[model samples]
Target: MRLTGTLDPVYNLRYVDSVNVSYYNNRLLPGGGRITVSVPVHNNRFSAWVPPLPAGDRLVLRLRYPEMPDSAGRILDVGGVSLMTGDSIVELSIGKGTYNPRLKKFALKADVVTGEQNIARLAYLGAMRLRNNITDTLRKKLYEKTIDSMAYNTAMQKASELRDSIDRDFIIRHPSSLQSLNILETIIGRYLNKQGGWNASGNKRLTEIDNLLQALDRSLRDSEKAQHLITSLDRAREMKLIPFTGIMPDGSVFDVASLEGKVFLIDFWGSWCGWCRKSHPHLKELYEKYKDEGFEIIGIGEEFGTGKEQWDRFRKAIAADGITWPQILNDPARQDVVSDYMVQSFPSKFLIDRNGKVVLRVLGDSEGLLDAKLKELFGK
Candidate 1:
């Protein structure tokens, strides 16, 4: 597709030697690749031909100025463009704009030649802006130590609900929009790592996401990516442990099945993770308090690599932290198991019941949520 743009000098365009342009397609996939190109700027004007977007796959464009900073001195995650029309000719005139209070970000207004795609682009901008605002606020709170991990997680969940509400409104208003389908897929995918199991609120979010997907244009709902997302949502509803054999630190085979019919915690952590190291003390306390009561803890150490240096670091960390629990390294043989468990972040904990069901899943507990659960279970 033909792309041409003139930038406003107010954005300090003179300092922007060139713009980094990239486009993302098949974004619903777990590992989608981005194609990027560098285009030079001359006298605040630049033009280039971007590849056409394939059908049923939404394409999102992004621009970065490696040397340019916004007036706030922040290289704001600046500009966005969402293209729904296939191979449509488009033109843009971009300019620096005032900070929008509602979206809580400094804005960049783009005058596009194609009106429909422009509206979709604006909707994408709004959704992303709101998401960034919420994320920034949470990060600030966490950085200031104003909120613990449990409260931070709770706030993040609330933020997700707010985003879903906004997306719901956008979908209802523009059921035919590909951006709406994108938003629906995002909502459905969020349930993959959601902490609580299929509880009341979880079921509500599932129903809401499914209903919104059905509300979209039939072409979008039937697309390959959308169908994949729907299948993923169905799988997320039936969560369970993937039984596997883990190799303990002493080179002995440890089958997770042996822990069945017992309450235990599976901790996916790494030695390099600061928060994981911090929680070691609390976990030790809990282990000592409840080991006699049929409670157990399993630590899956995900090191940077399986080299000798990495193993030394892992073992040294366990010794230094005084971790007495059975620790396993997520080596090549068990990497697939970690993938099966969908451990996307460090310090992911899955609390399993006697029946081997995942009662709760949390990331970076910081000793609050897990402590409470243990107390409720063992009456300590």
Candidate 2:
């Protein structure tokens, strides 16, 4: 087959990337796959071209629907424009609906929506290039402040702060873009601050002391940070400010406070969520050992597809694959949990003691560390 190519700066780029997917059941090793995204620069519309598969595989895809990234359009807080910021529609020409593998194209047809904000992303990249020499201390401060402010809801603010946080070399490698953790924080932080205030008090004071502390926290909080967001979310749940309930595996429901007297593991996941399943081995081992010690692993299935079919398959997958732990199919994802707890990524876990207080919030590998952690926590 011969492929013809043309350069139409706005509408001619057909790009795709490969992603690694893992089974929640811990039995299958992660596999790599491809996703194609079509961005019509002229119409500002985006479409995804999912790979076609056989019927059985297709069913699995349905049960565990992939979390298609929003082509920078579905960026939760694009440009620091939060749900809280009104009249801030930054007109992103986003096409709705998922890729219909049957049709091998987007399901809802190609069209444009009113609220996509890739502009912030563009501005963020531009600013990064313009001011590539910000000091680390200031950059960190900007990161924290951006997170604190929730500027991710808007494009301009996100672009500004992100520009400050970006590293010069990263862009040099990928000149068309310079994005990652720093960008997420700066944009997301701003959005969160404006929309919901990180599930905690805004700390909006203008005092020097507060500003200094904010700077310090921002500098100190880096790629290694954990629990801050989770802690904030937990605090909000305790206050009963949000009228929300969460769905657990087994198709049950409960609020965070309801599971108070148990040792619980809030596993953040989704059916099409590959990263969450990546930690199955550790989860399995942890459950096997500590389950007898009153350990209850309540997986808060995030994303969509928390139904029985998916849950059962997930459970079976883990069991057949070596995980014999109890799981609650989580619904509404962990809205309060993620927001209050400030969970930003997947496979993140929060260890709760019997009395219902968090012992630790883990962001990285806990598979090998689970046993050691439990022993220390159990004082055995």
Candidate 3:
């Protein structure tokens, strides 16, 4: 790929003597490799040849001018195009107007070479904006008050409904587009992860996703992303064993197999996760109330950061939080449990019945729903 841009000569002469332009491909390769390229600006113009990328991959451009100061007057004037990628030539014109040093902003105009590329670019840009808006809105609402669980649940449910509506509109408008397929995949994956397993609504959503996938080009349908979504949907429907055996914080071996003949919950959590910490009291309450009735909880703490210091911190946090359940702290070097369970997020829970089958999967904090499930199972 090639990029061309013109930076105002005035800005170049007064503020920055030179600028560095770089592009980073945001697609993850099969072996966890990344592709990136960089080039220097000459006479206010810059160009570079990017490495070949997969068809649906994204590439982002970044600009760094070390001589220009940022808002604090200590940092560089660093700006770039937002997340954008796919096969296309990107043209950007910067510093066309007066640069405001106080605002630390520059005027930028960007365009793609082809119509098809423009559509793809707009689709991704829209999707990213929607995601950010939803997340930011929910976060603001959640932290605005002393977290009232009822209010939080209501806000989240409304946000989810809005997201679903937006996703459906995308599918309806751009059924054959790769961006639509991506949106469908995201919707289905979130449903599988968040909704209680295998309900009628869940089944209906899966059917809709499958139909949309079928409507896409056969090559697109056979893409890695599509296949992965299909597999995840299939797995969500099946009651498969998610086996885990690890050492507890107190250094005792804890195994899922050992919990046979009892109803249990496998809680995926971590010390650093705010949602996990928020749900601790509810989990402890359930465990205490039902421990005599053959109900148990196995907390698996995932530590992604380095060093035994993290583990030590986790132990202290767990104790301070009054989490008395049987706990397993993950070895950062070996994340087999996380991979086995496809745990993309923290505070995930799986309810296993006495027959050793997973009966429910809850993502995030849904303590009320979990309590209801436990009552139904134990007839409390």
Candidate 4:
């Protein structure tokens, strides 16, 4: 199928500099075609021109500035006229022109955006959309429940799950009526005031929490459109036996591809794991000695049963401990990485080589042990 963009900022991007774009073997194109473009910003409005694109293909903008990638800056990712931060609003035009009504709209490439809040928004929107589509997609695919049951119960379940998730991970300051991640105690507190559930008049607390979370996440931002594409992208990757996003306790975003070019030792852990946090100093020392030589270690925390609020606590714990490498939050929802690496314990590490291949799978984390390995591998 042929693919392209539209005349919208969400779809349009002109290279501010030519050095940023590259071609991938993922598709066949000449001159290292621009993978993704940052729609230009001017006035209070931001818009990008997307050439007429085919429906099922994926596009990712390698947003960069001053010859370096904007690691923390927000870039608008949109579809149609929706200006957004972390996700993309699917163009009605795209849907009308390309997608069939019976098909599911899932994102295939989520990591294209490196911005943290941006990624969070993208994932949040994706989850919302996924929740909405349970009747249309999951139930049909899995044949689990009726559409009516999936809609009301599934959405409520998703919101409740989301509440438990961010309650610890994000320092939510939102009004109880504002949204879920903004404030859990407040949202649930308000829901309690609503008499609980759509039909209940006495359990207001549950009602308010459900409504508030629903409002904050409705429709999603344009940036999430890319994220939606990524969700679809993961299915494609699964065909290749690659893992999608893996949730960890650090609550940080993890990308299997981003670890390229460095030797990475990934540790799956938890804050409650006394053994996990204990490995930090040694990891710091390892990073200090081999960082220059291209050896690195990433801490992936498993907060699966611990839920979401633990994520914020997890980050604070790291800050309190002075953690210095990439970290990711892990949960049962996204634990493919752990399964992929076959992690059997806490403080587990998978030592990857410079070429991004898994080299040492069983190497235990020993204090000052990485320095010796670096010396052997790169001769420090």
Who wins the lDDT comparison? 1
**Tens digits of per-residue lDDT for model 2 on 1-380?**
01111221221122212212211211111122233222332222222232332111110111111354445222111122111111123232222344456544443211113322223334544555456444343466557774333433354455555553453233233332213223333333333333212322334422321232233333233223223433343453442222246554445666656656666776766556566677776677667776777777766544433244556666655555454444544333244444444455666666666666555555545554455567777666
Error of 3 at 277 (Å): 0.7
Worst 10 residues of 3 by lDDT: 24-33
Which residue segments of model 1 deviate by more than 4 Å? Answer: 1-4, 9-11, 22-36, 42-91, 99-121, 127-162, 174-178, 185-202, 218-232, 243-262, 269-274, 291-296, 299-347, 364-369, 372-380
Better of 2 and 4 by TM-score: 2
Pick by TM-score: 1 or 4, better one? 1
Lowest lDDT 10-residue stretch of candidate 4: 18-27
Can you write out model 4's per-residue Cα lDDT over 310-341, one digit (the tens) per residue?
56667777787798777776544434454444
lDDT of each: 0.69, 0.40, 0.67, 0.44
Order of quality (lDDT): 1, 3, 4, 2
- Specify the highest-TM-score model's number: 3
Q: Put down candidate 3 lDDT per residue, 1-380, tens digits, no spaces.
A: 45566665654333433444443321232112356676777776777766656555555566555545443222233455543445456665555344558866444434443435445657656675677787677678668865676877887788777777777776666655667665775666566576575443556777877777777777767887678667666666676666678888767788889999999998888878899889988888898899999999888886543447657767887888898778887653444575556566778888999998888888886887798899999999
Residue-level lDDT of model 1, residues 286-377, one tens digit each, is 88888899999988877764356567888999999988888887765444455556566677887888888777777765377777877887
State the displacement of the C-alpha of residue 188, model 1, in Å, after optimal TM-score superposition: 4.5
| Residue 231 CA displacement from its true place in model 1, Å | 4.4
How large is the C-alpha RMSD of every model relative to the true structure?
7.1, 15.9, 6.1, 21.0
